[model samples]
Target: MIGRRACWGLGGLVMAMAGCGPAPAPQAADKPRAEAAAQATGAPGTAGAAGPSSTGGASSAAGGVKADEATKPAPPPESAFTPVAQIPEDLEIRLHPVEGALLVSTPNLTVVEGEQTNVATAVGVLKDGKIDFPERLRVPGWMVTVSGVHGRYPDQLDLIATGTTGRTGVAEHYALGAKGWDQRVGDAGQWFTGVARMGSSLVGLTGPTMIGRSRFVTLRGPRVGLTITPAPRKGECRGFDAEAASRYSEAEVRPEAFGATRDGTALSYGRNCNGDNAVEVWKPGEKRSTILPVPAPSEEQTTDEVRTLILPGPGDGEAWIVDRGVLRYQGGEAKKIDPPAKGARVLTASAAPDGTLWALTDDALFTRKGDAWEQAPLPDGVKARDVAVGSDGAVWVAAGGAILKHGGASEAAGAAPGTIQLQKGPPPKPRENRTLPRPGGPKCPQNLVVLYTFSKTAPDDYDFPLTRKALKGRTEFSPARFVVTRDMGQRFLAAFVPTWDLAKKLEERIKTDVRGSTPQIVCATPEVVRELKLDLKTGEVAK
Candidate 1:
């Protein structure tokens, strides 16, 4: 049963950019000098003041608002949403219908059997007929293969993604708050094959630790750790050795080992020592396991001959498995559920709360109403990749890049001034304008500079006053510094920036402030930093 109580805790805006604070007051002795410098340099205060008299109290005396008033950046433009006719149909897509919305994901590239690596670029949600992308959530260096949203509505949810970095599988959780999403990440120390949501917690299944031994361990939490245990293999095949097979490898089936039920149970599929297939039901917070045998059409059939797909059913403890024929499992029994069509292949299936079974095939959409199955209308010459059922019983289909609603209008949501609007359109760009810088900062791959001390014998003298006086009151340059120990001995440097243009400005500023001193600006972007072996903080070559 779906829990009536809402999941996911709401909090204050987590992603809001901090507003610039008021500039410190100039010293009484230097007050007049400071005003003179501001006037002479035409340096605007927090406000846009353009004249010599704009500094000091001249602006206020002339009846203008205080200079510090405008320093706060415009509240980052609220999530700008635009209506679209269809999601872009360029890549393969998957659809997940939750309580109040439909989520669309463009899966990452697959390099191995059941193993996916690399980041998933886009994630969008369809709520009230409008789609708004929360965009991609990331961990600095982890390659995220799979990600999903766990929540009851489109507006509120937790985004979770898992992937491997080096030998460890990492999970990143992005929780939505008033402003945007906040991130929490964890490391599994082992490869994760797949992820599932159980109640409020996210669970991940780990790949085998040893070459031939099958261990069914799970990685739980952005805070939870891994628990390793051998999978139950009973019947005659209980002692089957995974390493003995030269022609067929158990690695191929590893990805299919674990699945989730609607009621938050983790389902494991395996064969006993004798080769008879069975499913072990492990619910959240439970220690005992229930094994249900899967009745194969013929005893001679091997696991490879029949493909299996486990799907969440409408009620708690219910699941639908596609093995030759569609079989529904509830309580502790498995029974066949007839296909919507005589021989049409079911690519994906979703069960609605009303017991309505929604299935997507190669060329059509079908819904099982009572005992009769009927084809759902779709656009002409359309090919859909997946299907899902919302809590309200709305059937959504992912065909091409467009979302199609059964027995509903083909256009996007209606347009209102501040409400989400929709249009029959192509996929929207990542942000409003592709060329503009993001709200908080400029994008990466920019030229940066560090105020370096070239004096090998007495570098400390140059480093102290240079950083204390020349770099003070400079809000544009970064505070972090880099240090490198080369043939020239050791040197200290400061200021890492994003753009070559910005670096040049910093260079000029430093030259004017500290007479006769040369500041060296270097290109130390993430990629360049890696190639040069420059320690990001110390600037020394990484050993």
Candidate 2:
């Protein structure tokens, strides 16, 4: 059941960009100086002080805020925000709140839309947020929205926009491959959305009317395209939508074995159908007349039906096909490997960085090294649904809304898990525009927050010498900075401050408590916060 609960705990903090005018153009005389600064700081094309400043002071400022703020009683437990739901058994849910749409799918590729409560139509879901589909294509699976209108793949591919009446064009297509002919032609005026590439050949299927027959087309090159004549199937075998097809495109179906040579030609393994669950060998530049025999599963396995396939490395006729709980190596025959007993249902399979095949089950994770299968220890009481390996070779597991990262030694590896903390707090309220004068030292722009670094030599000295332009009045000049200290060796110390209203508050408290020594303030942008470097002391923004 869907539920809602208010978010609790220390909400993640974020920094935002302030409004600023366009930067001045650079002069010929300033070129050398700008280049030298870029070389020294390793920042290119950032001249005239128009771009964001460094984040060296961010960590110290955050630490300072924690040190000075009075301890407040913890708020009552929140019950209004529901945690993000985990993937259900046999069902994958994709939610796009910004577009007010949800997509639920089964392993067999059956998809249905959830009732949208919001007025917006959800287009696609993102790591940070969700985007809505344009009014042109109301069908969800037809087009995958990445970011903006231009954020589509292969610009040449024509997509359905809005019709003359501003309504979405509702059309369906079916892709069929027989012999010699491959065509995408359907009823003259209707639109269809099924197109995929098998090797170098493109296959498209379309069904114009719900009760009408479907047409199949194949395109080899720019000018060479074939329209297949359906051999007259008896019943309604052609009217199904793109979602009904067990396979769509190479982009959607994950490849198991690739670049393998069969009969002196390159071959790859791909899932055939949702019901058949067989992997077919695909060779480029081959005629559609060739048919490869489907391999059989081992005797211990009841289900020969493969769900997911993975090829560890470059090899001929070598691939790993996953059928239920067993991991089978496919060559001449399917050899099943005993999976970890603690594993529930296998969720996903992938080749680890070390060439070991790994699988994520409902209850545990299993890894195969050479011929031995080992079960990796999971966090106590945590159930996982999805897993992915990062470019850094670290494994990431997603359960419910929590994300855990595994790093370090083999035993220690996958042991320590870090949860993904999303930034929270009510969005900043809108404010009126106002102009203010520059202050002494490095003056931050109006609406810009600044981070200050305090010197350790004068640890007790926290007073800041403000220029008259910035001290006009509290109403006209209210700049905030957050401050914290860092240990540079045992004898030396550094402070980091960010450019924001919150940082200004820290500066005010320091000046009020400690007098004399002036603190240095620097600007920090939101990009620094994502780097995970903004802690209490070091001020390094997370990358």
Candidate 3:
């Protein structure tokens, strides 16, 4: 129609317009455009239409606009970021965290900070800002004991090593320092026994009993050693026979054993194999000694059996003694309180700050307020090996490997809770194979004696009130024919009885229903309850 150039330009304009509209059919769309827009936008060329104006301006402008829009993207969602809660550091004693500071103590040192470091042989945190140490001095190849002195600051530590090449002896005083340890005292003799401290003075036992008996020697200041001459003869102190000597030989006595200073009076308890069988009160200035005799059966008593005595305080004027089956409060006269039960034995005794006498029997904890005794509950799965009252009115007891603490302020005797359940199946054939049972619910097998305990919330509560419902659910009950020994029963009661009210209620109920027959209910003091390592949860006594 027109010149070739004009025709080509018109064709290019048509192709450019087509590109702005809807897409063409697939087969047709594949054909190259012959318009100028196709050339400018890099579109393919068609055969029928002449390729017009190879450089196309209009198509190029449209392509630029489309490319600009594709570059813009939507913004991210609003909740793309949020804050999270952070867990705080835990600060519990049982956790035993390494970063936190712990109080380290020895006999001479009360509370000392480790320079540039916080590490020691013994480490514990301050309870109510007070430190109480159980045992301290090292006895070389034997034992080490420390006093739990509350509100005292540990400053210095002195180590006295006593032992011989083959036998036992006084090695020397070695000063323990920040760098390490250095020898401060020298070796003296073999067969050394007692080591005690009075105020600033140190007293030790040395020499052999066969070689004119061991001597009581006192160390004054840094190096002065003075020997205490025993009374020319055994005074009014009863049961100082051969039995006492044998028992005394094994007991460990320390300087702090004499107790702290108060009105120029010194109180100490002597321990023997048969419990606290003797009490001694000495006045250093007056050289006067008052001895209290422990009650014991004549036949079972031994000359070598020493008594474990616990002196309450300077003003109490009485010492509590644990001699086998008897718990006697000895002062001016020895009067034995009836044992918690016929077969129960006293384990340990401690005097509370309020002058309450706490005694731990085999299965129960007995507390004496004036003359009346009350019981309290022990913790579950715990048998008390040692019992002590903390300054904060909290009672601490050691059972098995664990130390248990009760938070109540009441002095009444109580058991912890639940009955001591024997483990399932036949007893282990060997002692080494007898592993203690774990706490909580476990189906006990036959052949074991299972004991169930109930608490008394009110008077006239159920005494062996075994209803059809109470007895209906059990698949197996503990055998009643099994022989129960006094020691075994004591351990059972200590572990099961949680509170004093429960112990009293159980005692009354058992006695009423059993008609003075079998399975005696015994009372325990908190101290004794802790010593037996009774399991409070299952009420099972650990062997």
Candidate 4:
């Protein structure tokens, strides 16, 4: 629709078109340039003009009227590249239907070199106004090509995209940075087939990385610990090569299709080794991996199959996997908290830190408790990929590539009667011994921690006096490092504690005496809590 020749590279979801030029004849590599590509997001972004000659040459005057006006040809429409957004900021999103294909990017003649200019504008699928990149390619748009289209996944934040220079039929490669809209630098021209994100680095699935011509690829990244087979078109990824697989001799061998997850400052990797389908799940802090022989994705299955989603719930030491529609744990049988919907199927699921579970379907997001499911209130027009619970029981979800979270110090999402909610407010006014000094930064003062529980009215009824009585001889109070909330809907309370050991002991006592209250509590230093990835339903901390 943008009126430009577009090339649909790999699977058509990613296309590069810049006058459909052929790669330059092999010789000296092209020189690297300072300028880069456009922003990846949809928002209109700005960049320096490619170069002069962008200025149209004046033409001869026409008939009688204004010869100068006729000669100027209204300076070429401005575009080294059209403005794009990599990822849009928080804004209302809509799922608009896409036409056959949408224009992804285009090239500018001014930026062309030796006749090549990698993708001036590539065309691909777009749905609901979102990039709608397929599952494993949730973060698409890195690979580009010429003559013949190939895909490549370079390091995260940086990638080489090849396209034509609109004017010349020569291919060019641009090294793109993932930060701001203008973070790009051109490189010696080369074609890339596919690219993917693993750890903080980007891994390429191109032939150049192949050892000689073998599918075995030695990529550039912090985790070169992996070697992949370059069968991008087939979407088939297997174990690392014999040489690379030996690095992890301590555990089962040959981990491939390594997917990453964050558990605090430490990053964890999940792999489905070729030797066996069992997935090895581990992070820095853990002594032994939580391995499960979840069947590997069959050749017929999509990339999501080989990619095991390792969810670590709050406080809970166990990690689990989701297969087909059931959950497989390291030591437990396949199970689902609730039965599948009558016609719909679950798309994603997660465990809450407190032992609750959540499932996502085409129609709704459901919470599970004791085998029963309840629909959580959510706006329409969006679908979710995964669910996460916060340390303080905040519900965080990756929906439509955006996070919709509930609970935590910030105002929580979805306020309805009978639903879980995190309570928060300005620091309580200082009074008597409660006038404790404020701790610098985002931590609770001294050894203090915060505890939470259900209350009738968070602000009105979270009696400091009543809480003091509850702890009786403990120094826990408001704004504890352990907790940062007080909500009204579910009557949430945030109680402070002087020490974690004291906090733990008091928590056990309160849970026992509170009995049916099933009050939820969360308290930990900001840094420790930040590293935790929890389940939305139960408060379990995920690995």
Candidate 5:
């Protein structure tokens, strides 16, 4: 069952763009020594004999209302809000939906607008068709709203917020779980673009488009670290003769290992690029690896390297290598693990974060708890290639080249395991200004508009668009930044924002037409932009 409770926990406290306080108070020009005293109190006319003085008194002598007083926000109207948050007087908060954060930029003069990372949310209810908290929760910048469908769930949400800071000696944090959400997206300023999640790590993107060099939140442990670059690019698979000739060879899979699979994070190029010896394997952003020594080849073991599969362990920096038996590597040492079943040879093994070992044999799966290995259930006729366990201890298997996920958390969940199909290549770009009579799709010029969708499953109208203004520059393109959800669903787009201010009008115009509220000014997050793959020199997406 989906969690019904509101999971609002502070993901992290981020401090970016340090020392960027207000512009140093704007220095004044030097004055002549004779007139210095008069210039100090006069408005350039030099108050000699009550020149241009106010009716009540000299303007500088008795001040009633100051200039900045006009900018002070009026008291919030009465509402049903619970907490009376002390909104910052001089801070611009930006919620990066893909990164799942609310940021405070160097004091600016615009309203806060932005996005969040997690699809999990549970905003109570919406009174009318819209959420009223926008006015209730005071933020000086854009307030972003992310809603739409993720996989099979309708993760609808509506939230109104602005961020505060530690300098103010106050902090607020929230977390949304996999449960309910109020209908409608948040206020009209910032719009949610995309989201990525791995365990508790969440990333949100909000800008010209969800594709390309867009900004996103990157969570780290309890606090949010910084945004990161997209997947690291690897040299083509045809080189590496020099690096392989000397020492340890990388793990490699056969040609048939990744048949028709176009998406892969490169591990290491093979020696001589021949792929005959060491090959790169697939693992998440983990640091664990195994290099076990094997005895002379038997009839069953044709080549020693071919049978060696380095597997990641469940704990931090743990790993194992299996060649008919397991060699556990932990604490900077590799040791042999006693076989669980009688005379049973371990074929492949996987580690869980909790340090549990689940190994595959000829017939059954042996799980090691403490010192004992016990048999665990395996679906019949499923030829397993690799086994995996999530941070939450859910078991998964790579079988027949598909990811099978088993579940027992809820009774409504599947009895057996289920397969998750990954999108192989880049998803096709969404077409815009078509004759579809869409709210935001009121027939736009083909040359002026470009639309990008999160994935193939994205709704017909749920597409993000950019115009010539957004992409203005002597530019080309590159492969987008790929961010995956917990279900392996990918959201990507290509962005080359020459000047965020230049694209402001266009971003707001579309937000008004499609969003049905006020338009929003969307600035791409600078910190998260580096995590994307950019063709900076060429300014074109790689073919």
Candidate 6:
């Protein structure tokens, strides 16, 4: 915690002893100096440090220690943040735990008027002691937050995320398919509270658009459109503010809690919006939801009702809600279970598939041991806010921007024995095509048009051969100059065809058939290519 605070302001001196005195006020004149100091620290996006005199000479050395030593930010506890993954020190990181993988979301931040605003979310996946952050997932202009991630039956994984365009929230589905990954954006008008991927169907719980009930909607894919289910008035309550409701959506029943297990998905609604609380449990493959008579938590039980977390229990029709304490719900009855943290605050908790409970508190992770709570062995000085137990019995912790794994197998996690494993391998070598010459810069036949260009990098480099084999009859391929607005100094495989219409048709086919290829249609003539300062062979930017 001291390490996290040290990076905030005042050369780490004031924040170290923040309680010792009144905070130093920022002055107009010191802004430039502070900015320079921030840049000097290699963390230009961090908040500026206070002026020297603002510390009242308090930053000076004490007990023969140097002033510089007192102000240096303390080394962060051993985790992935530092020398491990090389993530920037200043980005805000949030963790969402999946079955075998951990999703790390770091929002791109830029300082505007000394305040930071999120421009985009950088997505990274941690598995098998390594992090794989594909370049394409780092989308700009759209701010996306992942709400849930689920591993499908075979090699596929699906991400349930909400992308906001500053004006409206859009539900996004990222499905790992034969083409590596593809996204389907559903303009559901608002973000989903959470989603459950049951077998072949995806159902999401969101706020009620009208007063008196929360609504359930279907998400993404061709067969499933945005279909809203009307809510029952059983546990209707007035929870949302009248003014705020009109500001976002006219939904009446806001989702208060949601959770899912192998057996089913459960959700509870009735937040201050003029209704009593109701819990709905829907089993997989079932068209109807079973309404449970669950009451809302008393004010004394929870500080913020919106922050209440619901966890699916091991047994069918059972679920757990984490409010002030853990509450076990089954058979229309609620039972209070003693948390492993005792009276300490539980930051997050997870239930393993075998009914074991794991809870993370401020100090350490607690697991039930007989009748007593046992603390799991963690790296010394480590602090984490979230915990999840993998199916293989490995403990995963999300601290800051990095992921920490414990007790898992050394090999990368794999799909079940009967299921298809994730695709892995080196890039395939380009096929032998002797008759046609390799792509020459801007030397295309007058009738030839650029269909698509693929980067000569791993994963994508593998696509060249696959695309060649798949579309051998329709187009010709060559090493073409790949240009951005300017030369990117990278090698690329440019696909060419005789007509623009054929190129367009080929572009769509490649995106669908080729694995991991997202190509754009570009009709680059020699003059247009030269104007863009294009070159691909040497990977050196054209002067």
Total clashing pairs for each candidate = 15, 60, 98, 83, 45, 23
The residue-by-residue lDDT of candidate 1 on 80-195, one tens digit each, is 11222355433444555555556665443222325645444345666454555553322233334333455656466665544333322333455666655565544342223334
Query: Alpha-carbon error at 368 in model 5, in Å?
Result: 2.1
Candidate 3's C-alpha runs over 4 A off are 1-166, 169-264, 267-280, 290-294, 297-307, 325-331, 407-543
Q: What is the C-alpha lDDT of each candidate?
A: 0.42, 0.29, 0.30, 0.30, 0.28, 0.41
lDDT of 4 by residue, 293-376 (tens): 554322222211111233443333334343224343323322333244564444445555554656555455677644456777
Candidate 5 global lDDT: 0.28
Ranking by lDDT: 1, 6, 3, 4, 2, 5
lDDT of 5 by residue, 1-543 (tens): 000000011100111111111110001112223243244334454423223323324433565334333233332222111111112222221111111111111123333346633221112111221112322222222212112112211232223221213211011122333432222222111212223333444333221111112222332233223232222234112111223332222122211011000121112211211212222232344333222232211123211111223444544545444545655545545466776666666544544546677776654556774656776643323343334454445554433222334432321122122222222222222111001000111111110111222445765333233322233342332222311111112222323234333233344433334332222221122122113333435433233
RMSD of 2: 31.3
Q: Where is model 5 more than 4 Å wrong at Cα?
A: 1-309, 342-347, 369-371, 377-388, 396-412, 415-543
Residue-by-residue lDDT tens digits, candidate 6, 291-344: 555553432322210124566566765666654355677665666666565456
Q: Lowest summed-lDDT stretch of 10 residues in model 4?
A: 431-440
TM-score against truth, every candidate = 0.45, 0.32, 0.37, 0.30, 0.24, 0.48
TM-score for predicted model 5 compared with the true structure: 0.24
Candidate 6 regions with alpha-carbon error over 4 angstroms: 1-88, 96-101, 109-119, 127-130, 139-141, 152-155, 176-182, 197-202, 208-253, 269-276, 283-286, 295-307, 368-373, 400-402, 409-543
TM-score of 4: 0.30
lDDT of 3 by residue, 1-543 (tens): 000000000111111000000000000012233443333334545223223333345436655324333233322111111111110111101101111222322212233455553222232433332333333422222211111212222334443333222221233444434444344544432222323445466544332211123344454344323333342233211112233342122222111123322232344333322223343456545454565544542223211111133334324444344433334343455466666556555434555555465666655566674656666544332333345564444555433222334543533222232221212222112111001110111111111211332222423222223321232332222212212112211222222343333433433334344332212222111112223322323434335
Q: How close to the true structure is residue 110 of candidate 1, measured as C-alpha lDDT? A: 26
Q: Candidate 5 or 6, higher TM-score?
A: 6
lDDT of 4: 0.30
User: Per-residue alpha-carbon lDDT of model 2 for 208-292, expressed as tens digits?
Assistant: 2112233334433343232223322431122222335331122111122222222222222322212122333333354331223
Model 6 weakest lDDT span, ten residues long? 18-27
